[model samples]
Target: MSSTTRILLGLALGAAAGLILAWFDPAHAARAVQFAQPIGRLWLNALQMTVVPLVLALVIIGVSAANDAAASGRTARRALVVFALLLSAGAAFAAIVAPLALSLLPRDPALIDSLRDAIPAQAAPAAVGFADWFTAIIPTNAIAAAAQSAMLPLVVFALFFGFALTRIDATRRERMVEFFQAIADTMIVIVQWVLWAAPLGVFALVLAVCASAGASVLSALGWYIALLCAMYLAVTLLLYPVAVVFGGTRLRRFAAAILPAQVVAASTQSSLASLPAMVESARDRLGQPRAVAALVLPMAVSLFRITSPMQYIGAASFVAWIYGIEVPAAQLAAAAALAVVVSLGSVGLPGQVSFMATTMPVTAAMGLPVAPLGLLLAVDTIPDVFATVGNVSADLTASSVVARAEGSSEPAAPA
Candidate 1:
């Protein structure tokens, strides 16, 4: 089957499973659904098994390449600056859209009251202080950090190893790079095989979630989904075009070229999973160099995740409002800055919730009431889909800027 055919098949099967599971009452399929939970767990494990190594390899390669380009003349500096600007714009757009969407949403006083009641009130963090931020990154045990998938420490370790490789003898550095590359390749092969079965896995996972929780969680969440879609649309239509113009790329062409991948990302709800399609699109349609596309796209998948922060921002804001906690403007700014730190400091798959758990000072300072993360946990699927699409789209746009700055012979084309 064609790639499109496969994607459609997966989507259809996954949707079928979700609908069936949603319709399943505990009285009807308690034992069978209970039995199916472990299968979903196993599937999650398959994806997670690749998480650390995939992140380490991709980060090492990206920084190494970025460092090389940075060490070059003015052109490379310009490219790096443009890429940074694009990232900033995407993140800022997400943050702005959250508040704007909140404004547009019809405040359901009754539903809000019910949700507020459901949420246990807790004391806000004592202060927006630095101690909490400092303590989050410096884990006592490397193993414990890895077990918890502490993103900052993991990123620190990967950066340390990559840069350290640069300073060593050329022959040994090559050997070390090759060693990591080999491991990365092996893991990618494993991921490919598992992805072949992902349709079943995705279906089972959705089934488990629906069966256990029921649709009540999302019945009143239509507004949340709409808010996320608006945010996604803002990033794509407004921020990205501005980025393209600023970066000296042809804005119309860039968006056109990347539409296929963006659509796929929306369906898959995973930037990491969409890497192959993004890379292919960048190389073939966008005319990016294979070397640049290969190195940057994977790194962007693992490291340059802006959307997770956006999700966290939206979740945090909603939860704060639900709890009647006043988040001052200063706190929102602090939250945005912290969002960047938490995103960069995180490891594992892009869009994973654990990263937020690890990076947010609020998660630590606020207790169990904050623990539920109820707002996001309710509408994760909808937001995750939109965010993943935006994340990959932004990455592709940055790649175009980078390619142009590198002075590649390929003329600027519409993406």
Candidate 2:
């Protein structure tokens, strides 16, 4: 069968499986939904398998390659400038969207109880202040941090290694680059082979989410969905487009260039899983410079699940409001700051929501109930589409800005 045919089959089977299980026994439906978990898990594991090696490879390659693209100092400065602008824009966007989502939904006393009941027992402790934030970033041990998959520390370590690789003599650096490139190439091959199963994996992931959620979850949270739609529109239509324009890209061309990454990201509900494709799409189809696409896209996945953080900000504020806690001006500003900082550690992996959960210091500080996290669990997949789209858009925008300013001789593939 053609790829499109296989995708159709997966979608059809997933939908039928979900509905059949729901009709026969809603409780059993959840069991059926479990089928998707392993597929999704395997897919995520494959992506993560390459994280350390790929980051090491790309950053080393990026720094080494930067020397050839332009003056090393200028290239580094320009990339940082683009990255910083994107980060600031993302934080501002979250701050604006949070207040809007809160204003649209009235507080429900019952929701707090229902949400509390739905929460798993091993809930994260409420974060209190700067100390709690500082403690979260400090891993007990470096090896343990890498072993336990602590993202913030892993990034810290990788950046140090990448920078070190750049300081080596050219011949030695080139040899090191060749070795790491082989590893990256091997990982890329594995990533592509696994991607053949992507449509099925995506269907399984989405179907499981729909089947497992209570029938009333959607109906009861109608206003929340409206808020989500508003958030999506603002991000998709306004914030991302403005970023693209500011970065010297035309709207129509930018959309065309980024659509594939958006589609894969939307369907997979993961920016990390979507990374290999995003890299290829941006390089081959979007005509982004190789160094720009390779460097910015991966970094963007780690730093930008744009819509998810926005959702969390909304949830944080709503939880505070419903529980009769006034989020002080200082606290709100702090949350805004933390949201941006925490995003640097957000890999586009399955536990991303959990990472956002960890980022909620302001909510915890204000004595807000974390129960509203349950409400977010229901709609996570839905809003992921927008988040992933924003992620890809930011990468492309950064790529364009960097390319233009650097006058990198590479032209992205024609849209």
Cα TM-score of candidate 1: 0.58
TM-score for each model: 0.58, 0.54
What overall lDDT, based on C-alpha atoms, would model 1 receive against the true structure? 0.57
Q: Candidate 1: list runs displaced more than 4 Å.
A: 1-83, 108-117, 124-220, 350-369, 411-415
Model 1 per-residue lDDT tens digits across residues 1-415: 7423453454445335544654754454444456655665565567566656655675576556666666765655555665556656555665566766566545545544443333334566445455565565555776675666554556556777788888989898778777877776676677666656655554454444444444443443555566667666667666466546643557666677788898889888778778888987888877787766776677566556656566556666555544445554445554565455445434353223343232233332222134234234323554667677778887787677666667673533553
Each candidate's clash count: 11, 3
Alpha carbon lDDT of residue 169, candidate 2? 90
Ten-residue region with minimum lDDT total, candidate 1: 359-368
Candidate 2 lDDT over residue span 223-309, tens digit each: 555666676657666645664656566777667767787788778766677888878776776566787777666655654455545
**Model 2 lDDT vs. the true structure?**
0.56
